[model samples]
Target: MSAQRPKILIIGGGFGGLFCARRLAKADVDVTLLDRSAGHLFQPLLYQCATGKLAIGQISRPLREEFAPYPNVKTLLGEAIVLDPDAHTVTVRRPDETEFVIDYDVLVLAAGMRQSYLGHEAFARWAPGMKTLDDALEIRQRIFTAFEIAETLPPGPERASWLTLAVAGGGPTGVELAGQIREVATKTLANEFHSIQPEEARVLLFDGGDRVLKSFAPDLTSRATQALTELGVEMHLGVHVTDVRRDGITVTPKQGGPDQQFAARTVLWTAGVEAVPFARHVAEVLGAPTDRSGRIQVEPDLTVAGHPEIFVIGDLAGREGLPGVAENAMQGGLHAATCIRRDLEGRPRRPYRYRDLGSAAYISHGHALLQLGRVRVSGYLGWLAWGLIHIAFLTGVSNRVSTVATWLASIARPGRFHRAFMLGAADRPEQRYTYSTSDLPAEGHAPGS
Candidate 1:
């Protein structure tokens, strides 16, 4: 081995990889962060982008710019199709469809999860998800286009079908999407449309659980339900969406409701998520097990069972009972970096520990729900807290300031949604599979001596 510092490879530009890169900023190590997307998306606020409340640019920052201050850290835009743990190499597929290999002394896997169709992968053709920029843009198109399409159709079920919006899964993403659609129909797009009354649009939220936001406390769930009811969202609880077609969906509600089919042209699927396919590759390469969700069963130190040099953090690791939220990724990334530093210094690596930083969800208009441990706040106060907290969590100073300004402007202006449908032509096209590490101007660092 040459007398150079150890090399680190971090995958996924989400919270885990981003945080892990930051944690190793001043360390005596070389880090290369890879992600398929060019930007590091603030996924929590992605609902806003889908709803036209915030532009995509405001929430996603380029990974290259995010880590420009750290000379030891480099950002590469590409996807990892294969991970060879025994060989300590990752095979990357670039946007151009070519492939290359990069060897590493240590690796951090955090490729994040993708929207799942609950065994109905065919459902994806009709009901797109709210996970990526493409997904958001596609949902936005379907939404606004539905409204526009409704204008021409004569008054009937066809018009109603165009007016209806069905959102699968009553989780945070589903709730936020439903709430925003309600606001648009009742308040934002009220006077703008001519043929069909926007207020007449039907917004449906379906969930398998008896209550929404199941991860939150009971009282908060009750509060959110009440708020959603006031917004005119039809909550179909104890329901399982069995099938999704181009025109509608089939739901089997546990409440003894008949196998009912809801007719709606627009659908958003936020029901479930499985780790990115790369996780399965990692599990296979490591001879490790994975949960039903396809997330790797990582050890206490956020590493594979017997591979101390390889760490799996964030949405890709499932052994820990941590929620797949931003907080988990942030803390888990930090833990991986700390353990790596310890190993480099000839010290024992520590077990990974996660800190529950609480959770919050923005409902609509001036309403929100915030939960910090045992305490729960709802309504406008919670909404205010949500705003402040999200702004604080944004990556950069400029992004934070501009995001606040843009948010305020969006709230003040209702006409913004009128023009969003024109930005993209496709309604949720297939994602591009890409990743890279060779584009860096600097020479690759030799592995640990």
Candidate 2:
């Protein structure tokens, strides 16, 4: 609506938002990119950072630095709290909770999803999900600190509890986290400590599905299972994590059976994800239909019904056959950009057609799985392809180079140079949980039968 160049407002700096902005970098438009976080996280490799295989800097790039070359793109740090589609304005809350307004002619909602606790939000204190930089750091701290705590305790149940790690999810994130933890225990910290054998640590992976990596073919899943088993990861499939506490988790069979309790000090959650809070608010204001997970249903052109100026993409877009993956998000972003360009030129906009680029998952050291159409590759060959695909998709040349260097060094030796983690309020026991001591399970025994 501006007499000047059209004002384009993009909410989020993830794959979708970033790609859209980059495509419009030289366009005759003023772009405002807003995100709650300063850096654009490379989420696929978040587990690597959590397990110390890569540094946070290697997996994330600051938005300011990323957009320094794009004169038309102005990046701001804020969380979009309210949407006024009718007025073409959005209210954003700053880091200090102060509110401001942003006006736009065209809006792009690429704000991605957040870790979902399903229905139990209280489980968050005990189980940290793999979604953000803070989550990665928190998991890293828990992992390394658990090892250190185990070293101090003599051979006993408490030490074993500290050495036990649990991951709740069979998806790519869960599988990657489980495998990386085992690899870290058996390889990186195997001989680093004299008090206890780090290789003896137990990593339990739990999922309600019958097998891990259910997105892949049965053979690929079988190969992943074998690789995980060989890496010393105990797979507990066909079970649901019913309850989580400060000390352990209770798993009940999905087919209805007695519950089994596992004492684990560190639990990483990658079970599910839902739209971020802002995305939900946007959906409400726009009267858009969303799937169960809060993904807004969009027209074929990635626009809301009766609101073609507003585009929704990435994990937040609910469309048939549109997988919530980085490749899909990137392509969606470009499509949205192309639509906007076409609109400016008075040309008819085309519907978005998502191209499936397949999927890849890293299992362990020198092992991975890659599937594209009928082409299924596993083991060393698959690992190489997986690495190439990731490296090519990673943003920025510096990040790609550093990540490759780090990977090569890690492969050549057992040393993990980025193992350092911080301990702040996490060091305090009283600040951990709101529940009283009476809420804990009986000593030496779990609560459920």
Candidate 3:
């Protein structure tokens, strides 16, 4: 072994990457964390931002600031495009469209997952997925704009269509998003509109699965369904969405029935997610096997089976029928870090054993279902537990305090929806200024010019 410390490169700034970096802070390794975004986003609370319950800045913190205490760690703002495992080099595209290469003795691939439309890319133009801060803000705009448009429509189906909101998927994200929307409509937006009562707005929660919160116990699912129903949300279970378009969505029941079409202005898809493209690149580069979800098949120690030096974690690493949750990603990151640390110190590495911390889903208004092993709690108490646990798990004191204050304010007044929409001048298609990390014009250049 060389006398110099090994250089470690982590490809993500999510839960997995963040945890691994923190764990290896004191180790004799040079750590470099790379991500396209400048800050670390608390993903679980992204739905709140979409619903205007929280702002985008409230749920994110600067990545450099978070890792500043550890002098051995460095943050790079760039997107990794190619990973040459044989050469131990990573090629990344900087914001200036320049490619940079970094040599790494150890690499952790945790690029994470992105929204999967299942071969329906066209649907993205109308119904956006909640993944990044921009996505959340765009959805928030669509939601608030729906109400704004409804105020001008005559009282009829046209108005109802404008007030209607449809959410596809019944997983934790969809459930939490639907619940937050219900609260916003019934509470925050109750008296805001003149021609319509936001409380009567139609919020549809659709799931192809047989029930919501499928990962939870059956009893908990039943309770969640009941709570959502009480909150006036129309639950469509076991229904496959046939088509999603700008107008609406068409669905067919799983039991073989007539197709049902609903006309709505806002449609949100949280149904499925697939591993980011980097995972496939890694698998192809290493000639390693991967599962159907495009996640690399790693060993028990969270390292690539054939190439032990390369580690894969988070949603990009596949385990047999394992649910890709934040907890799983964190555990995988820690395991990979531990393995690397042990190898460096000439110690035996421990296999990763996932501990099920249970699952919780927030249902309508102030109710929730929590399953902690044999213990299951429902209703208000469960909601309290859920809030406390989430608050505790949130990173940084500013985010925690801001989230708590937002929750308390929502509970106290419940009609204060922060409206900060700025409508700019209209422009032609060619003149439209689209904002994205990958595509931005030069500092002084006009969008169209």
Candidate 4:
């Protein structure tokens, strides 16, 4: 062999890892991109999928397909379970539990974060977080099924409980969820329901902060509050969700007041996030420091101290003034790729500098918020801008096309197209259908027949 190319191994297929790999596609180094899941998910649109506004396919694309054009990049499906810094190898566990080792000359950790239950893991069973596709599907099931269950029950507190939905968090995700739930009730299922009026559904939003969308400007938050209020989302601020149960949640006032309870059948969580477990493991193995949220602290060049070969980026990266957003991850990925290319070219690496590209949040139909430096836009104008921004950043062209088409269709129609959900084994046993065999058409007398 004339020469050996540098082997670059990247963990996670989120925005950071994927963008980094793409940036290094034409480089001489061989790259291995690995992730636990097979698809690259557009996480910002996950709430839309959960609310039946978009399909799973519209928000995610297969990673292998995404990287097929780059012959130098190889994709693998596995979870990084163990890290050995001395050996420069990472141990990964396959879906079948088989263990394998990947050795690399350069390593990039961008595994991202997961929803935090605030040290209450048990709450996950009752309140599904909007972090993954599975979580979105689970929330979809609970949301649509709750309405179906309510349609069968007589008008009473039980029906009201089934129609009541609770959302924990005042951030972008929580705001989007609360707004979508109300829209789904008032517009989508208004004419579909028979017994209980879907418009009467209750959407309760609880957050410990004094106001919603704390990350945005105060004026933008006020606009968002007005939109949500008009849409009928009950805002319960200055309260912490102390307990989450199967049928309801208990909230305690942050300023020291008596705890209160709200009965709800559907609970969605988007309060906080912590670095994924593998990121924590990598921090320990590499002797790197991490924050309380388990984000690995990186040097100015986005590399671990004393370990130039190792780079940490994205939400798992802990840096002052670096917001845990997609734009940061994308920029960090490009910077890391540039550093690698510079090393190959015998040039000195430069520090990573982040550019503030602003942030956006959707409130309801024809309402959104967009904030740039000293510039804020809300209402219909912000809504249009929000659509354009999301479409521009969405992963694939096909996904963008489909998502836009779906959105247009949703605007013209009164019902959600992707509302189907499957019942799990546990739920199947407890389900009681309202209709029987008599409700179906006779064997040879189908509607078409």
Model 4 TM: 0.93
- Candidate number that wins on TM-score, 1 or 2: 2
Query: Whose TM-score is greatest here?
Result: 2
Which stretches of candidate 2 lie above 4 Å from their native place?
Answer: 1-3, 425-449
Candidate 1 local lDDT, 144-228, one digit each (tens): 8889889999999888998999999999989999999998889878998777899999999999998999988999999999999
| Candidate 3 lDDT over residue span 1-449, tens digit each | 23688899999999899889888888899999999996788788788778876777678888898889999999999999898877889999999999999889889987898998877766676678988887888778778888888899899988898789999999999998888888878877887778888898899999988889898999888888888887888899999877775557888999998999999878998988887887788898888888776888888878888777788888887777456877887888888898888889899988788887778777755688889999999998898888888777777788889888887776655543555654333454433322222233357743211
The best candidate in terms of lDDT? 2
1-449 in candidate 4: lDDT tens per residue? 01479899989888999899999998999999999997798899899889888899998999999999999999999999998888989999999999999999999998999999988877776788999998998888889898999999999988999999999999999999999999999988989877989999999999999999999999899989999999999999999998886668899998998999898978889999998888888888888899999998999999999899999998988989899999999999999899999998889999999999999999988889999899899998998888889888889889889888877775666357888887645335455232223324457642211
**Model 4, 248: alpha-carbon shift in Å?**
0.7
Top-down TM-score ranking: 2, 4, 3, 1
Q: Which candidate would rank higher by lDDT, 3 or 4?
A: 4
RMSD of each: 8.8, 3.1, 5.1, 7.5
Alpha-carbon lDDT, every model: 0.84, 0.90, 0.82, 0.89
Sliding window of 10 residues with minimal summed lDDT for model 3 = 431-440
TM-score for each of the candidates: 0.92, 0.95, 0.92, 0.93
What does the lDDT read for residue 105 in candidate 2? 96
- Model 1, CA-based lDDT: 0.84
The TM-score, computed over Cα atoms with residue i paired to residue i, of candidate 1 is 0.92
lDDT minimum window of 10 residues, candidate 1: 432-441
The lDDT, on a scale of 0 to 1, for candidate 2 is: 0.90
Winner on lDDT (1 vs 4): 4
Error of 1 at 129 (Å): 0.7
Q: Could you tell me how far off, in angstroms, the CA of residue 234 lies in candidate 1 after the best superposition?
A: 0.7
